[model samples]
Target: MPRYLFLKHYRTGQTPHPNAADRWTPQEISDHMAFMDAMIEDLKANGQFVGAEALSPRGTFVRYGGEGKPPVTDGPFAETKDLIAGWMAVDVESEEEAYAKAAYLSSAPGYGGRPLYEWIEVRPFLSEADTPDLG
Candidate 1:
């Protein structure tokens, strides 16, 4: 079995949805959340749902200040352009299955029963057991 990550990226200050979530009707928002919940449940049922998570848009970049100093941060730099909205890591039997799942995720609902065709980056995890020794 191999694991893969479905990276879902979002543009900061860029509208992912023509009608942003905040602008959606309360019922529309609820429906959107419900859709996500159902998707997760479906994945779990298939035993391919390893994990998923969402990231906050407001986060800062931290770096070491100096040898004797503390960490330093310029501020919430990720807010400037792009953001990794969230990701779903799954353990599946094949690459095609992973790709299928990624494709399925792209059809999430947006406004008025319309589909949000967001682009997803699908990548596989390196399986140490499957790798050949160089030496």
Candidate 2:
């Protein structure tokens, strides 16, 4: 099975819900989270769920320094356009399956119980088994 990563960016890609989540009501936020949880449960039941994580907007970009030196970073950058809201990893039999799953996830409800219709970035993992033969 090939593993795919679904990247959920914050207000960067196309989406019906353009407003920030903070603008939504508390109940709306809860509803959105509930939908996400239910989706994960469904994926788990199908044995396609590998893992999922919700990221904090505050992210630090770290780069390798010289030996025995601290990594260099420009401090936390929480720019909404550059922040990734989260990611979901799924192991499936085909790329189509991955796309289907991502599409379903993109429909997660947002403000006013409306489908977000968000754009999800999907990419498959390259494992040793997928390495091309050079001989």
Candidate 3:
């Protein structure tokens, strides 16, 4: 099974619901958690679930370009438009399988009704055989 990463991308300041700015009530969070639980169960039953996680908005980004170049740049960059919301990694048999998984994930219920502003980017993982291992 090949491993693939499902990345969630969204613009900053996009709320899940019109009233989301008010903060999640306990019931709202509970409902979302229940939906996630169901989704996880379905994934496990299908053997398509490897692992998943949500990431924080803050990140440290480093860029390198130059002779004898030391890495430059630091966290808290000004660009919020291109920030990643989160990611999930899964192992599947083929590209078709990967696509199906991503489609299912995108349809999963979230904060409010649905996350219209969110998008999923599926990418296959690189295997050790595909590159020379330094270690």
Candidate 4:
């Protein structure tokens, strides 16, 4: 089975549901979390769940500068254009299955108990199966 990653981003432009989480009521937030938990449980029951995580917006870019001349650091890029909120990894049989799962995840509720319908990026994990025969 191929593994895929579903990435949720903090995009502002062209968002179908633009309810900021900070503005959501406590119950709405809890309901959203509960929905996510249920989705995970369903995926697990189907043997498709691999792992998931919610990322801290505060993050830094680090680079190995020279041999050992102290690592170079860039930013705690909370305001970057491509900010990722979270991700869920799934091992499934096909790309379509991955897409379906991502679509379901995007249906997670937002404020007013309406579906967020936010975009979920689906990317496949490459493996030996993707490599061509060089012989």
Candidate 5:
């Protein structure tokens, strides 16, 4: 079984299923998270889940000069052209399985209990024979 990484990118030029995030009520948000938790539990029970996590929207990019020099951060890095919201790693038997999981995740509940239709990037880990430059 090979491992695949599913990346969830933050906001972009694309439009959300519902119009805006603020449209979602508190209970709707809770319900959405509950759905995600249930999916994780189900995946675990089936022995197909490896791990999953989300990243904070805000982060600092650091540049180090030397051991004695402190890292520096510029405010512009707060939001870049592409912000990766989060990701999920899964060890599956086939590419179809990975795509299936991605599709399922994309169907997560959104405002008014509709699907989010989030785009997930599915990438496979490079095997020893796949990477020629690593050596």
Candidate 6:
């Protein structure tokens, strides 16, 4: 099976609803957890689920030009224009299957009575065939 990445992208500074920030009470968190539990069960039943996780927003990116060239960068790169919020990797039989899974995931619930303006980007992972089978 081929591995595909389902990446979630969203705008960083937009509130979904006027009172969205205020809606993050304990009840809202519980409801979100329940929804996630159901989604996990659904994914497992379909046999398309490999693994998933949530990531912290904080990150450090390093960029290097050449050997001993001294990498330059700092925490929290200010380039959120094309930043990826989070992602999930799933193993599927084909591109069609990958797309189907991504579509299903995008339909999952989110805060503010709808998804967080997020979009899923499905990309196939590079395989050994892409290069030479080192074996």
Q: What lDDT tens digits, residue by residue, belong to model 6 across residues 55-126?
A: 554555788858878776665563543456567787778899888878777665456556533457888889
- How close to the true structure is residue 21 of candidate 5, measured as C-alpha lDDT? 48
Ranking by TM-score: 4, 2, 5, 1, 6, 3
Runs in model 3 lying further than 4 Å from the true structure: 12-26, 64-71, 115-117, 128-135
Better model by lDDT: candidate 1 vs candidate 2: 2
Candidate 2 residue lDDT tens string, 46-84? 998999999887787789988999988766674566678
Q: What is the C-alpha RMSD of each candidate to the true structure, in Å?
A: 3.0, 2.7, 4.9, 2.5, 3.0, 4.1
**Model 5 bad stretches (over 4 Å):** 14-23, 64-77, 133-135
Judged by lDDT against the true structure, how good is candidate 6?
A: 0.65
TM-score of 3: 0.66
Q: TM-score for every candidate vs. truth?
A: 0.77, 0.83, 0.66, 0.84, 0.78, 0.68
RMSD of 4: 2.5
Of models 3 and 6, which has the larger TM-score? Answer: 6
The CA lDDT at 4 in model 1 is 96
Model 4, residue 109: displacement in angstroms? 0.6
lDDT of each: 0.77, 0.86, 0.68, 0.84, 0.78, 0.65
Q: Identify the leading candidate in terms of lDDT.
A: 2
Superior by lDDT: candidate 2 or candidate 5: 2
In order, how many clashes per candidate?
0, 0, 0, 0, 0, 0
* Model 3 lDDT tens row, 3-122: 999987644344343333136567765765576667667878888777877666566677885779877766457355455766778778998988887887766554554543345789
Candidate 5: clashing pairs of residues: none
